[model samples]
Target: MDMKTTSLPLSDQLLEAIEERIVTGAYPPGTRLDEVDLAKVFEVSRTPIREALIRLETMRIIEKVPRKGWVVTPISPQSLCEMFEFISELEALCGLFAARRATPFQIQQLLSAHEACRDVDDPDAYYRANEGFHKALYAAAGNSYLLEQLTEMQRRARPYRRLQLRAPERIKASFAEHEAIVAAVLARDEGAAAERLREHVMLQGDRFNRLLQSLEGFGRAGR
Candidate 1:
């Protein structure tokens, strides 16, 4: 796979910012997204905001009604479960392939990114570094199509995953999971890497229940 990239355009930048807000519950379910107000907030014209809204609609993060304009899509518990289930499988594939195929250079890069995560005290910094660690795994998988699909799913799930970071002791646990995954990859143990990755990616068992409770609390607070 080619390792080329481009910076996000103004519209995409706005889309990510707005999406983050939506995921973080700043603009909870049913919140109206006014294009003109967004344009003013971002100091950009309506064209970019319009484009961003269109992309959000495509992601099912928002929807337009006949006369109600665009509103944040409500996330049901079932939908959240389904999203994480898909993400878990996708990332498991990435880890499996990466363990079987990663080059020495790629392994070193993954370690570096993991180390960066360990060094960050701020949640945002850790989040960015965590992203780098996962992207390295995707790149190491050596499949362009899988990388593209996984990237999109990851982007869509970013907010929920970010919320997980706020859970008690989650950062430390996440880093430990990353360590295990990195070790599995370096050892060329495909099954171990895949299983570890799945567990790490999925909000299952206790984690899933906790997140559901938190979301419920957030919904009540918003009302």
Candidate 2:
């Protein structure tokens, strides 16, 4: 993808700022996002901020309050599970079709994308490279509808997915999984590629659940 930094529209900029903050945990879940404060921070009027908050609300990222402004939505374990389950199916289908229809060029692109993530250590870098790998895989599937749904699911899952790369070990494991999937796709093994992708996505959900359980335990211990 191009690295162009095109200027965002006022409302889009506001939305992006809030989304970045939330994804980075700067504004943790359940924190009330004050429209006036955000407007001042972004140096814009409340009109754009209001519009941005409405958009976020539509994404289920924020909840509109009775008297207060929008508050960050709390992601429950159940909701996380459901989201991941849906994504697993979508991505598995993508991988299946990609194996069936991927051209040599597309397979090479997927391999190159996986190679890019081989030794990435920085969390953000690893995350971006991993995302590229998935997107390439989705495109290789050659199903426009599948690609669109996968992209939407990815956007909705971004915040939680960002948390998955907190450890270098997780990043390494993810890259390894990507490599295996690429190998299967290149070999035109549709069933194997789909199985690998399903396992990979499900493993991510498992890791997230384990992290949540650990956090709950730590909270109970007042840590």
Q: State every prediction's TM-score relative to the real structure.
A: 0.84, 0.77
Q: Return the TM-score for candidate 2, rounded to 2 decimals.
A: 0.77
lDDT of 2: 0.79
Q: In model 1, where is the ten-residue run with the lowest total lDDT?
A: 1-10
In order, the Cα lDDT scores of the candidates are 0.84, 0.79
Off by over 4 Å in 2: 1-29, 39-55, 65-67, 203-206, 213-223
What total of clashing residue pairs does each candidate reach? 0, 0
